[model samples]
Target: MKTIASCVQEIIISSPFLEEGLSREIINFSALAKDLNKPISNMLRKPVKNGAIMMALRRYQQPLNLENSNRLKTTFKALGDITVRSNLSDFTFQNSKTLIRSHSQILEKISANSQIFYAFTRGILESNIIISSSEKESITNAFKNETLIGSKDKLSAISIYLPNGNSEIAGLYYQIFKRLAWENITLYEVVSTTNEFTIVVEDDLVDKAFSVIKRLKD
Candidate 1:
């Protein structure tokens, strides 16, 4: 089995679509191998560690089809290779009667409960804060520490994971959001960590948002 790097090199070489130029030459493994004076055989001998090479091939084979694949590339290029998993914990308020307010007001109230808030930048809204006991502490703590360590307003946050700090994939979030915004769905807060992204929305819009995301995902 050939390694991923080598496979990528070969794929680039095999693709006539890459064009004839320095940029094309740079991505081509044979050229790169010669330029760096490395053994082409050595590079091709190793199987791809992850699925990056295969991903690249998929991209060249079909441009517009791999909506998710393009997302993976854009994100991987920006954040590096990362593992994304949906967080299972739910958010719920102690009282179901908490008044809905503007983003600033919501942040202020949530901030009073804790210091560290869950934040995310992009992605779809799945549901309203379902405040189960398991997530209360984190929620409460975020409220207490309302002051997020950023130049912008850091009231409440949506915690997100970034496998390797890749921001290019952030565009995928933008893509999903464009349609939502068109439909008048407003996003309140965003926070990202290392692995996943989360978006907070108004309680009233939770169900609608979830449906949109479900439709897009499906």
Candidate 2:
């Protein structure tokens, strides 16, 4: 049989925002108990009273605080280095495979001269590429069969390098993203490798984003 405490922990882990409400004492226990009874009953194979559910929620709140603190420590430690690049342009291409074959030389030229940011979606319906603004002319000439959806210039790229061992830590990216989201900065796109995370945004927001991320290191 599943214990009340275990069931409560499962619920909090699954719905992380619930812990926030519980800890703030903003959640109405009666409604929460009623809503959770069905799932908890399903898990335990027996019905539970509302009072038992409320008690379980209260018991698990302290543990959730400790867990969040440990997660923040791990995430901060994983962030090794941060950098920003500006004056970039983003291009979206349709029918990318055809474009690749038709303009191999031009593509190579752009690749050699610029920091290329490229992603191809499954089924090859669309491909998005970004490069330095100086390579715009070469990229334009390269498209024979591919449709140029649009291009955006004056963009900035923020590169976050993670520690070697902790690069793969869970929630590391989320912590960075959450900080950006909190500041209401719109992201153009995000690209990542095993040890590096990059977010592209408009050039104007670069300083604000950099400051926000710098605080994470403090």
Candidate 3:
């Protein structure tokens, strides 16, 4: 059986945006009580009042601490060299030795003319190759399979170089994603390496995204 305190704590921890409300002690008690009453009724055999839920919330609240806040801000500041690249294209290839050969061939041709970013997961080899509109035909022809090309001028990439000692920190990516999600920014794709993280978004949102990241430093 779940107590009101445990239930309220679970809700706050699971929701990144709601965590702030908990910190500020401004969460809606009525709404929370209503949400939990049905499920908790099965366990406790009765409905609980908003006042009881509110009391449990206050009693079990986990306030944000200065150490964690300082660590996060430091990590953000250490993220040096935030760069945005435009006029990008994306290609997703099925994972195979043939795909690797095709990728190499395409890379040779576009090495001098464009910037290439690629990643390999379990079954897909995804590439976001930034090239000029005039060079698109030459690049596309190099691949044997159908390649998915994105809007020529609409896509943009934002790359962040993480500071040393912060790349391995837990919840680092969550902090970045949470800010973007809160602003309703749609991420086209995400690429990451040991010390760098990159996200592709519409060109229009580049500035807004950059601003959101910079605010983490403050």
Candidate 4:
């Protein structure tokens, strides 16, 4: 059976901003319950008193970071390396049947150089290619016939090597990203793998972004 606490937890966890507010004790419990009253009542299949939902809100604990804090700290301490690449180009192209062919052509033209930084992230309706600014001309030549959605220049990337198997640990990413968010850093793109997390930001903000990420273990 779904208890009031379960329903409250479900609602809060779905919105990170609300969860953060609750954690910081900045949310007014009664007001929150007022807003959540109908939803919680619908969830419980019965009318729930707003006061009871408020009580549940007060009782709800953040299951994400409290237990995982120490483990996340350890993982941060063991972060392998912080790699920063500059003068990057970000190319976003609308998805198309011919998009993959264009990508293949670009790879064939440039993958020979092991020194350059290159990354490609595909989304449902679009895809992004981040490469050294020097490759801008090559990308243009390859995607000339395709739909160029948007692009940005003077970008930089920060790739943090995570400890092995960090994927299994909940809140690892939240802890890492929360700090950057606090600093008001606008993330252009975020790419990650099993053991690595990379963020793309404007060149001017790279220093502050790097500092925020570096201090996560501190």
Please identify which of the two predictions, 1 or 4, would achieve the higher lDDT against the true structure.
Answer: 4
Residues 1-218, candidate 1, lDDT per residue (tens digit)?
Answer: 66554455564565433422324334554444343333333576533323454344334432344766676555534432222223223333222122232223545655656532333221232223423233455454553433222222212223234455445444566555654674677876544445666665555565666555544433
Error of 1 at 150 (Å): 17
Candidates 3 and 4: which is better by TM-score? 3
**Segments of candidate 4 deviating more than 4 angstroms:** 1-67
**lDDT accuracy of residue 182 in candidate 2:** 62
Worst 10 residues of 3 by lDDT: 114-123
Per-candidate TM equals 0.31, 0.65, 0.80, 0.74
Q: Any runs in candidate 1 off by more than 4 Å, and if so which? A: 1-170
Number of clashing residue pairs in every model?
Answer: 47, 0, 0, 0
Which candidate number maximizes lDDT?
4
lDDT tens readout by residue for model 4, 29-76: 999999999999999899999999989998898774555777777888
Residue 178 of model 1 has an lDDT of: 55
Quote the lDDT for 14 in model 4: 89
Worst 10 residues of 1 by lDDT: 148-157
How high is the CA lDDT of each candidate model? 0.43, 0.74, 0.69, 0.89
lDDT of 3 by residue, 67-185 (tens): 77677777887778888777666545445555667667766775675345433333445444544445557556766474553334467788888888776566789889988987888
Question: How close is each model in CA RMSD to the real structure?
Answer: 15.9, 5.0, 3.3, 3.6
